[model samples]
Target: MNQVIRGLSVTTFFYMVTLWASFALFHAIFDKPFDHDWDLSGNFIGLFMVSVPYIAYGLILRHLENRPVRRAVQVSLLTVVCERVSIYWIGSYFAANGYGNPIPLQFIRGEAAPYFSIPYIFIGGIVSVLLCVAAAGVRWRKS
Candidate 1:
């Protein structure tokens, strides 16, 4: 349990660092703040940004004496829950600060439900973990 918690902390730290750095780089190149919802490319990059942490998390836990699939599922569930909560909180903060919600307008307008995106995220997490496992050649058998 403690190991999972520690792994999550490290994963989250990397995610934030990568996110901020990506934003900074985009700003430097474009001479403007990156609006994550302003274009399709932004959304694609956002998805990639979210996936990278899951891959890292899987790699971090690969050495545990457990099944790879189990570890992968853990990484998926933890990341998805955290990601959803973080999005909601950030959107709320932006809205409260008069910057407007960062969440897509479709969600706010009832054209799409935010919760519906969970399955896609979960699928992405599974794929990311599997990629890490394959790339690292992590053994599934318990030690």
Candidate 2:
């Protein structure tokens, strides 16, 4: 029980920090606010931020002592929910503060997630699951 909570908390923290740090990096490098507009740099940063956290999360779970494979997968799915909601909340925060375009927030809030980002989310989830599975497979082969 404690382990599951710790896993979720750590991964979610990674997700949030990664998201914020990417935006900060974009603003620093481009000298402009990140407004959810996918200019060339934005596209790369956005995709990288969306996908890397899941990989990191899966790796963390894989290395955690005594973490079961099933629990790892479950926590990965939960992070998807966390990611989507964070997008909405964080985008809204940016919009409200005049740091971003509200158009993206309108689309996200109306539909529960930006339509364009859904595929990336699934890809991240799939990668996370694959990492978990591969870790278990290696253990099984040794036994």
Candidate 3:
């Protein structure tokens, strides 16, 4: 129980730090910084970009450590959810912000994840599941 709480805490901390770091990176790179906006908040888009799939993958990995097969099922269901929500998020972000809409199925390199399309979410879930699977597979293999 304590370990689970610790894991979640660590994940959240990592997520937050990542957000801040990304904001910094954006400010450093782009002349027009975005984290300040409300309707088209870079922070908000970034939250979905980094955190949603990150947390989902983390949860899947945690479950995989305890129960591999069950976690796979969980990952599958999560993939579905990620696929839809992520697609919508990307579409809305691009539509409103006029940038960064191309995030396609990233499991395979060079695939285009177009805005307002199913593939955006599909990529989100695919990337998450692939990361979890690869990590868990390596760990389980070592054990």
Candidate with top TM-score is 1
Rank by lDDT, highest first.
2, 1, 3
CA lDDT, every prediction? 0.56, 0.60, 0.46
Question: Which lDDT tens digits does candidate 3 get at residues 1-143?
Answer: 45445444544555456546655655576645552443343334444543454554555565546764345445444544644665555555554554542433221111222122333345644654555445444443354
- Pairs clashing within candidate 1: none
Supply the TM-score for candidate 3: 0.40
- What TM-score should be assigned to candidate 1? 0.60
Write down the TM-score of every candidate.
0.60, 0.59, 0.40
Model 1 residue runs over 4 Å out of place are 64-66, 93-143
Model 2 sits at a Cα RMSD from the real structure of: 5.5
Across 1-143, the per-residue lDDT of candidate 1 in tens digits comes to 87667766877787777667666666676776444334533544456565676667666666653565575666556766776666655555655666644554334222222222444456655665566555344655758
lDDT of 3: 0.46
Worst 10 residues of 3 by lDDT: 107-116
Candidate 2 regions exceeding 4 Å error are 39-42, 85-116, 121-143
At residue 24, candidate 1 shows an lDDT of 64
Question: Backbone clashes in each candidate structure, one number apiece?
Answer: 0, 0, 2
Error of 3 at 11 (Å): 6.5
Q: After superposition, how far is residue 84 of candidate 1 from its true place, in Å?
A: 1.0
